[model samples]
Target: MNAECGICYEEYDWKERIPCIGICGHTICDRCRISMTSKKCPHCVRPDAFKDKNVNKQLWDLIRFTQLVFRKHSFQEEEFSEDTKRCSHCSEPSNKLRVCYDCCIQNGLVHKYMQEAEQKEENIETVLQNIRDQALCGDCVIDGVHFQHKTEYVDSFIESYSRFLNNRN
Candidate 1:
């Protein structure tokens, strides 16, 4: 075997060689195997003969990790929306990346809707807890657009909750 890998620029050693077969029934290294991707062989780049399920698994794992970071920091965007926000991770401009529909679906976990839901829940809970704590006087409105008779406990609760939340954020 050659002493070096063409893709990784790593020196091919005896330890790096895996038991998998190339198209010519030659033994290749793990780095080469992954580089070949879904193809049957790194050198040949065919799809049918690369029988190891682990190869696909490894590829999926890589994509999954990338999808996570993309979703997290808005670096990766899926094909679901042409809008939303740009991803911060990739150097490529927003127009250049191939946004995948499947990846977009997976990326739904770290979306703006999720953030809005959390904020709504927090706001509702804050208001409810404020009512429970009697932070408002008899004349405080839950929504500023309207007025309601809130108890002393509710007033205190709202005050305390506001301080608690302000400190937390």
Candidate 2:
């Protein structure tokens, strides 16, 4: 009954992480909702049951209340395990200990420079190969924002949720 989604087991947020309730009354996070296979409630296995899903406002309110309670209790900060922390790119903790791409680039983990002709002529495969060669974590090929374009390393909602969990002590 906490803020986590039963499907993906990720924490809910007020923005994109909002929870949705299926016709069968099972709640899932928006991420899972978007990835659903057949508009069916995964929990109930009812085909098309989730065609008209609604936002679980009550659960969202409960999450807010819980956040307020935790803040009121003055919970102590706790250390986070690698699994609980998210990657700056994909926002998933697939690899908990990977270094940021900016650091890698600065440290010469990848080629410092490519020829202008090569850079202009490079294909997607070449880019992917470079990303792999750099050994950057967080699915850079698929989900990474260019380092120059990155304003925030972590998702704000996930960061807040991590704080909430860590302060439970």
Candidate 3:
């Protein structure tokens, strides 16, 4: 059974993020299914594949059972763990936080009311520095397009600088 959604790469949760099978026999998450702008399956790109399809409950139950077993096993291992490190957010006995990446991002978002409470001007330098740090960190790069754009920009800048140096000499 496919434990994760191919499109979003998120584990199929028994709740809202349930697994669904398209008419083309490709599995996707419910959220992705709902947000689908096109009638085609993202995986196989089959036209009208997801049209009038519902969540595959039988498949989802199997995936859910597997996830439960894995989590139980992980907890059992954690019980025998000797590591002293605890998660900062949850105080869980682990090096990593228990919160999911999406939750962390959502929680980190600054609302308009919070921004108004601070009433501070945007620090461009700090923002730029943060972006630079994220871009240089290989793990933080999200999109191929973003990487390509940055690469092309840097290449163009280098070429221009080389030309300027040659003209000066």
Candidate number of the best lDDT? 2
1-169 per-residue lDDT for model 2 (tens digits): 3568887787776556678988888888777888877898888898777687589988877765665556431111123343454444433333322444454446543333455453343344444344433333345533554444322233342354335334333
lDDT measured at residue 130 in model 2 versus the true structure, 0 to 100: 40
TM per candidate comes to 0.22, 0.40, 0.38
Off by over 4 Å in 2: 72-169
- To one decimal, what is the Cα RMSD in angstroms of model 2 from the true structure? 17.4
What root-mean-square deviation over C-alphas does model 1 reach?
Answer: 19.2
| lDDT score, candidate 3, position 94 | 35
CA lDDT scores, all candidates in order: 0.39, 0.55, 0.51
Locate the minimum summed-lDDT window of 10 residues in model 2.
Answer: 72-81
Tell me the lDDT of model 3 at 129.
33
- Model 1 lDDT tens row, 114-151: 33335533564644432332222222233332233222
Which numbered prediction scores highest in TM-score against the true structure? Answer: 2
| Model 1 TM-score, 2 decimals | 0.22
